[model samples]
Target: MEGEINRSVHPIFTRDPEDFMQYLNKQVSVLKEDGKEVTGWVYTIDPVSESFVLLSFTDDKTQLDIVMGPSVRQVSVLDENSETYKKRIEAMFRPPEVEALSEEELEKRKNVLKSWLLKNRLPVQVAGNNGELLSISDALFIEPPYGVENCRSTNEIILGRIQGLIKNMPSDQEEWC
Candidate 1:
């Protein structure tokens, strides 16, 4: 009932190194003429079969027959069950939380927000005072790394405490995070 859906969308790539790109223009023209063009959204294009894709926003599950450079292939569709679909959608790009990551997950709350709200926002790299790349890798490594931190100043205090806890670690260990 729950699994990744990698529906094929026709036009998959082929192994012929020499004839690979020969059918490209024709394929595009066909898809366009048929009004079956890929909708404007991000879909994972298969490297070998450029036609195959994992489309996430279709209205329903169905296979598409696509004419590729010089051939046609049937791509299969694997729709996730509703429950699994909802969960996957929810977990997509979430990152670990700092104060809470110390535990496990942390639901985003109304009170919790980004720190960038109160602080000055700047680009990742402009010349630092030294005119060199000011690697904000620290911000990158810290939980909630970079941008403005959410939570109260107390959350910062907690983060500082965690940092203190790591103070005694060996330099090699400390180099991490």
Candidate 2:
């Protein structure tokens, strides 16, 4: 009977990492075997087992819940988080301890940040021998120029958009190129 219910809901347990990645940092409704619903922002998905970790925040405190891979009946993404909410989530989950950085580490981080800024074509000004800063507007609008390259098939356009979205996601750890 439970197996029947799970099959009826959705086969979420067998989904791939990319499929599960779509729910990350977004509010979702998870239907359980007993017909109860749990809703929260998806924190992470276990790539090996495909289980889900959800986080719920209240005025007084925050709560974290884990739903086993086989027990997840169905998942429906509810809403996307705003930039402020994304920052809050990142800060909340950041490691509690702050380690003193060595000069080598500081130099490496600065180089990475500079490379990222240059790749994005953001206006940057060198501040000193070892550091740089950039002044940005509260909102910057960019209008993509339409051309033959922009006129792609629906499927192609959608794939490109998805790839771009994935590329723009924040990484907690440093990625070496």
Candidate 3:
């Protein structure tokens, strides 16, 4: 909840797309005008209309819900899972591979990946910079992959490590010191 926004007070509908995009890919507890609460990972925000695309996973199925901006009363970020969620969203709608993509196409993909990682506060190390790693507290460094399948496997491994870490962490009361 580091950067929680109270939409009732701030009027998110009137905010710019850059502001709305801040909530993208993070786990959030959203309160609607009708008083109903919904929790999910933010997938994206429509710049034109400021609507939120949220993703919720249950069992084997994944559900995507769109909450209109005007109806949102508040949005409280639950956790920072933006990087993982972004990867999930990308995998869902990724375009088929072309035999030979142009330089511009590669650059575009790189920029998109870099932007998402930076926005999510995920640590990243450029592939060809002598392989020198950059470390951030409580952050994991995932190597850039060559293809979609490799990226998916890397994500799964990272997720598994995260789950294991969560399971081993001290409880709230124990960390009060």
Candidate 4:
């Protein structure tokens, strides 16, 4: 609702991804070509297809609606529900909790990963203020525990390769460390 649009206009189909970002977590009323109106909180918009996903919440259930780009006649902001709806959307997709590992066990896992990377002849280094990060490349770093999920990289190719390598790492490889 920050950049509220008043008039009935259809620019959503041609709107840039940046424009869609503003609608995220905001209550919106989308007018379709057939006169059907959809009102919900904006969850996501597909950059490629321009289709947007909306979430409608009730006391006991949440409903999801995806509106196609071409069918949308107009999209107007109704209100901002960023704080409440954002948490709900996140919770909907949040992964289950995992058991916490002790600091010593976490350190050992990190060391094992570093050793494995070394064995594979991949460049690796300790980075970050507290030396808690494993730097693999300019755009890539693996957080503590050194698991695939902890790997972060701007480059998708590099990220995928590193995560795949870690996933396929032989069990005996840990014994070598």
Best by lDDT: 4
Which has the better lDDT: candidate 1, or candidate 4? 4
Ranking by lDDT: 4, 3, 2, 1
Relative to the unseen true structure, what is the C-alpha lDDT of residue 41 in candidate 3, on a scale of 0 to 100? 90
Comparing 3 with 4 on TM-score, the higher-scoring candidate is 4
Give the Å error, residue 60, model 1: 24
TM-score of 4: 0.56
Per-residue lDDT over 1-177 for candidate 2, one digit per residue giving the tens place of the 0 to 100 score: 555544353444555558877887889889988888888888788876567888888899878888887778999988976342554565575433212334465456445544554566655333422242221121211111111121223365544643353245345423422
- Model 3, span 1-177: residue lDDT tens: 879876574444565667776787798888999999888898778776567888987779998888887888898999886776676665675444422455455545444444445555666444533332222232443222222222322355675654344344344412311
- The C-alpha TM-scores of every prediction are 0.20, 0.48, 0.47, 0.56
* Inter-residue clash pairs, candidate 2: none
After superposing candidate 1, which stretches have Cα over 4 Å from the reference? 1-43, 46-113, 123-177
User: How does residue 168 of candidate 2 score in lDDT?
Assistant: 56
Using TM-score as the measure, which candidate wins?
Answer: 4
Candidate 1 residue-pair clash tally: 10
Better of 1 and 2 by TM-score: 2
- Alpha carbon lDDT of each predicted model: 0.32, 0.56, 0.59, 0.81
Distance from true location, Cα of 75 in model 3, Å:
0.6
User: By the TM-score metric, which is better: model 1 or model 3?
Assistant: 3
**Alpha-carbon error at 38 in model 3, in Å?**
1.6
Pick by lDDT: 1 or 2, better one:
2
Model 4 per-residue lDDT at 98: 17
